[model samples]
Target: MSERETWASRAGFILAAVGSAVGLGNIWQFPFKTAQFGGASFLIVYLVAALGIGLPAILAEFIIGRKANLNTIDAFEKLGHKNWRIVGALGLFTGFWILSYYSVVGGWVLRYLGGSVTGAYFGAPAEYFGQISAGMDALVLHAVFMALVVGIVAAGIEDGIEKATKLMVPSIVVILGALAVFAFTLPGASAGYAYFLSPDFDALAANFTDIVPFAVGQAFFSLSIGMGAMITYASYIDGDQSLFGDGITIVFLNSFVGVLAGLVVLPLLFAQGIDPNTSGAGAVFISVAGAFGSLPAGQLIGVVFFGVVLIAALSSAISLLEVVVSWVIDNYDVSRPQVAVTLGGIIFLLGVPSAIDTAWLGWFDTLAYKFFLPVGVLGILIFVAWVYGAPAIDELMKGSGLGDGVGITWLWLARTLVIVAVVVTLALGLQTLFLGANPAIIPPL
Candidate 1:
C-alpha cells in the first residue's frame, strides 16, 4: 500500500470539513434564499434537505474517498474503471469553477472586514457597497484574498493550511455565537427571531414547486456537495471511524452556523428597523451596514461580526483550494508550493470576470448550485448506488459510530430517492436560473 497522509487529529479533520461546509453560503446566500422562498417555509425545506439530501451525498463521497484512499482523480481510477476516474475529475472541475467565483467573494469579505473597522460603510450602506462591490476595487480585494489562500497552500498542508482552519473554525463559532447573544439584547431582536422562525406556510405551499428546488439546491451547495471538497477532505481521514457519524456532525455544525448567522444578523437588522426579509444579494449588506451605523457600539460589533464572516469564508475557501492542490500533488507528485502557485495563477485569471462583472457573480452562483452541483451530486449517487452497490454500504458502515443500521436505510435512499430527486430538482432549478426570476446585473465579486 502506498503511504497515505491523514489528519493529525480527528478534530482537525472535522473542523476542516465543517469549515468548508460553512461559508458565505450560510452567511450570505442562506438568508436571501430564505426570504425569497417562503421565509419559514423555505427554512423547513432547507433543514430536511440538509439531513436527507446532503448527508447521504456526503457519506457517499466519504466512502469513495476513504475506500480508494485517493484524491478525486486517483480515487475513481483506483475504483477500477477508467470511466470512474472521470467522476472524480468532474468533481475537481466543479471545485475549480467554484473557487474561481468563491475566492472573488472571499475577497469582498476581506475588504468588508477592514471596512467594518474603518466605518467605511457607516452612514451609506448602499453607496459603500456600490463603490466597493464591483469594478477595480473588487478585483484588487479578490487578488488579496486569493493570495492569502495560495500562500497557505504553498507553505504545505500541515504547517500552513490545516492549522489555520483549526483556529479559524473555532473563532467563527465563538464570534458568531457572541454576535447572536449581542443581537438578542437589541431592541427588536425578539421580533427578528419571530420573523425568522414563523413561516407563511400558505405562501410556501403556493410556491412549493418553484421553492422546493431552490431549497434542495441550497442544501446541496451549502454543504459543499459534488464539488469534491468533501471527497478531498475525506481523503485525509485515517481513523476507521464511522463516516456516517462524522458526516452528521459536520452537517449539523454547518447548518447551525447558518442559523446562528441569521440570528446575529436579523435581530440587529430588526432593531435598526430594517426588514429582515429583503431582496437581492445586496440586501444583507445594505441592512447590516445600516444597523452598524445606528447602534451605539455599532462599529465594534460590526468589526467582530464581519470578522467572523471573513474567517468563515476564508476557512471554506481553503477547503476549495486544497481540493485542487491535493489532486495535483497526488497525480504529479509535485511540491505543494508549485501546485499552489500553478493553480492560484489559473484561478486568479479565471476570477477576473467574476470580480469585474457583478452579474457574473449571480450567474456563477446560480450555475453552480442550480446546474453543476446537482448534476455532479447525481453522478456520485449513481456510482455509489448502482456501480459500487451493496459493497459500498458495508464499507461505509464499518466502524462508523454515527449510523449503525442506518447504513441500509441510507443506501436505499441513495439508490431510490436521492438520485431521482436530485435529477428532478436540478432540472427545475436550472430552468429557474435560465428562464425565470433572474435579473441582468454585473456580478460583484
Candidate 2:
C-alpha cells in the first residue's frame, strides 16, 4: 500500500471544505427557501441551527477522520468499532445519492452559463428553462458536468481539488460581492432587503414547526454536514491542526455566502418586478433568468452570475465525488484515475432518469434531504459521543487551544442536545415524507 495524500496547505484544505459547503444549497436553494418561509425569520432559525447543531456535528466527523486517517467506513473500523462502520456507509451512500441528482442541476448551471453568453434565454426565460431543464439536452449536459468533476478528482488531491477550489472559492466571493453591490443600486432593492432582513416574530412563533425543519435541513445541507465529504477531507490533514477553529471558519464563510447569495438574488428579482416568493425547484433558474433578461447589461450580468454558480456547483461536486473515490482507492488496488472515471460513469448513468425527467430528480433529492441526511448525522453523533467516547475529545483538542472543559461540553452537547435535535428533525422529515404532507414546507435542500 502507498501513503495517503494530504492537503498541500491549511489554506488548501479550508478552501476545499468551504467550496463543498457553499454550493447550490446556498446560491440556488437559499433564496427561494427564504422567500417561501418568512425570509429573515427563516434566516434567524437557520443561523441558530447551523451554529448549534451543524458545527458540533462537523467536529465529530473531523475527529473520526483525523484520528483514523482513513476513508469514512474504514475510519470507524480502524477505530475499533467495526459495527459503527454502518454510519460511515450511510454517509458515503448519501453523498453518492445526492450527487446523482445534484449533477443534473450542475448541468443546468453549465447550460445557463452558455445561454447567458448568447442571450439565448433572455427572450423567453421560462420557455428556455422548460426546453433545457430535461430531455436529451439535460442528459448530455449532465455527462459534461460529471466529466469535469472526474477529470479534477483523477488529478490527485493537492494538484487538482485543492488548486481548483483555491481559485473557485475566491472567485465565488469576489463576484458575489460585486453583484450584491450592484443589486443594492436597483430602484426596488429596498423591498427585497426588507423581505430578507426584516423579521416577523408573530409568523415565526405561529409557524415554528413548519419553518424549523426546513431551517435545520438548510443548515445541514449548506454546511455539507451528514455527508462524508468533510470526513474524507479531514482524513487528508497532515498535522494536529485546529479542527475547532477550522470548523468555525467553514461555518462562518458558508453562512456568509448564503446570505450574500440572498442579497444578490432577492434584489435582482424585486428590481425586475418578478415575485421573489416563487416556489419549487425551478424558482432560481426561472425567476433569476427573467430578472437578468430584463436588466440593463443583462446578458453580461447573466454570464457572470451563472459563471459563478457553475464554479460553485463544480467545487461541491468535486467533494462529493471525492468521498466515494477516496473510499475505493483506500480499499482497492486501482489507481485514482481509474476509480474516478468508472465511478463517474456509473453516477452519470444513475442520474439519467433525473436528467430525462425532473420529477425523478425531485424524488432523488427528497429522499436524500429528508431520510438520508438526518440519519447520517444522527449515526455520527452517536458514534462520536458514545462509541469513540473520551478519545474523540482528545483528538479534537490537539492544537485546538482549548482545555478539557470545552471538550467535555462539546461531548455532552453532542450526546444530548445535538442528538435529540437530529432525532426530532428526522422524525418530522419522516412524517412529511410518509404522510403525504405539504412538501413545500420541507423543500429539498
Candidate 3:
C-alpha cells in the first residue's frame, strides 16, 4: 500500500471539495438552466434535491473514500461485496467523459476571458458568440484547455492541485459574492428577483416529472456527485475530518453560488435591457458579457466576470483529471507523466467532435448531464442504500459528532428517499434526452 497523505489542513479539504462543486454547473450552467426551466421554480426543486438527495449521497461516498483511504474501486472493495467494485469504476469512466467535454466548455470560458479584456464582443455579441461557439477554432481552444489540464495533473495531486485550487476557488467565491451584491443594486433588480423567485407552483407541478429529473441532474452537477471526483478527492483526505459536516457545507456553498449566479445574471440582463430568457443555456455568458460591455466601467467588470469563470473552471477540471490519473497509476503503476499523456490523449480524441461542432457539443452536454451523470449517480445511491447498509452506518459514524444516532437516521433516508429520488431523476433524464421535451405532456408554457 502507498503512504496516505491527508489535506494539509481542514480548510484545504473544504475549499477543494467546494471548488469542485462550484464549477461551470453552478456558476455557468445553473443560471441558464434555471431560466430555461421557469426560473425560481427550478431553483426550488434543485434545493430539495440538494439537501434531501445530494447531501446524503455525497456523505456516503466521502465516508467510503476516506475510510478506505483509496480511490473509488478499492474503496468499494473495502466496504462491500467484490461485485461492488465495478460501481466505482463506472463512476471513474463517467468522470473521464465529463472532463472531456468539460474542458471544451472551459476552453470557451478561457477564450471569453481573453475576449472580455479586449471588448471582443462589444458591438455585436450574438454574431461573435456564433462565430466561436463551434468549429475548428473551438477545437484548438479545447486542445489548449486540455493541455493545461494535463499539465496540472502531471504535477501530482497534493502540490499542483491543492495549491492552485486554494488560490483560485476563494477568488471565485469572493468575486461572485461581490458581483451578486452589485447586480442586486441595479435598477429593476426586483424584476430580476421576480423572474427568478416568483414561482408558478402550477408550472412546477405540471412539469414536476420533467423538472424533477433536471433538478436531480442539477443536484449531481452542483454537488459534484457520481463522477468519482468526490470519491477520488476524498481518498486523499485524512481521518480527522467529518464527512457529514463537510458534505453539508460544500452543498450549501455550491447551491448558494448557483443562486448568487441567478441573482447576478438576471438583474444585470434586465438592467441591460436584454431579454434574460433569450440566451437560453448560454444566457449567463452572453447576458453578463453584454451587461458588462454596457456599464460605466464595462471592460473592467467584463474582465473580472470572465476571469473569475476561468479560475473556477480550472479548479474543477483539475479534479476530473485527477480521477483518471488515479485510476491509471493505481491499476497500472504508470508514471505520472505517462498517465497524463495517456489519459489526456484519449480525452482529447473523444472530445474533438464536441470542440469543433455546436451540435456535437450540445449532444455531449445533454448526454453527459441528462444521461451519463444521473445514471452514474443513481448507481452510487443504490450501492450505498442497499449494498453497504450496516458498514455505511459505521463509516458515516466515524468522526461524526453524533455517531450511531445520526448515522442511523441518515441511513434510513439513504435507503428510502435518496434511492427513490435518484431512480426517478435518472429515469426522467433518460426520457428527456431521448424523447425530447414533450411540451404537451409537460405543460402549456
The number of the candidate with the highest lDDT is 2
* Ordered list by TM-score, greatest first: 2, 1, 3
Rate residue 243 of model 1 by lDDT: 85
TM-score of each: 0.95, 0.97, 0.94
Q: Is candidate 1 or candidate 3 better by lDDT?
A: 1
Off by over 4 Å in 2: 438-445
**Which stretches of candidate 3 lie above 4 Å from their native place?**
1-5, 279-281, 437-445
CA error at residue 47 for candidate 3, angstroms? 0.9
1-445 per-residue lDDT for model 3 (tens digits): 2344457777888888888888888878888888778888898999998999889889878877787777877778766566887878878888888888788888788778888878898877777777776777778888898888888778776677877788988898889889888888788778888989899899999888777877778888777888898998888887656788889899998888888878888888878787766534456767777778888888887888888888878878878878878766766655787889788989988888777765666666666667777777777777876777777777776676775878888988888888887777877777776676442122211
Provide the global lDDT of candidate 1 against the true structure: 0.82
Of the two candidates 1 and 3, the one with more favorable TM-score, higher being better, is 1
Give the higher-TM-score candidate: 2 or 3: 2
lDDT of 1 by residue, 10-114 (tens): 788888888888888888878778766746788888998899889999999999888887888888778775588777777888888989878888877777778
lDDT digits (tens) for residues 1-445 of candidate 2: 5569999999999999999999999998789888888889999999998999999999998999899999988999999999998899999989898899899999999999999989999889889989999999999999999999999999999999999999999999999999999999999999889989999999999877767778888888888888899999999999999999999999999999999999999988888888877766788899999998888899999999999999999899999999999999899888999999999999999999989988888788777777889899999999999878999989999998999899999999999999999999888777777775555333343
C-alpha root-mean-square deviation, candidate 2? 2.1
Residue 240 lDDT in candidate 1: 82
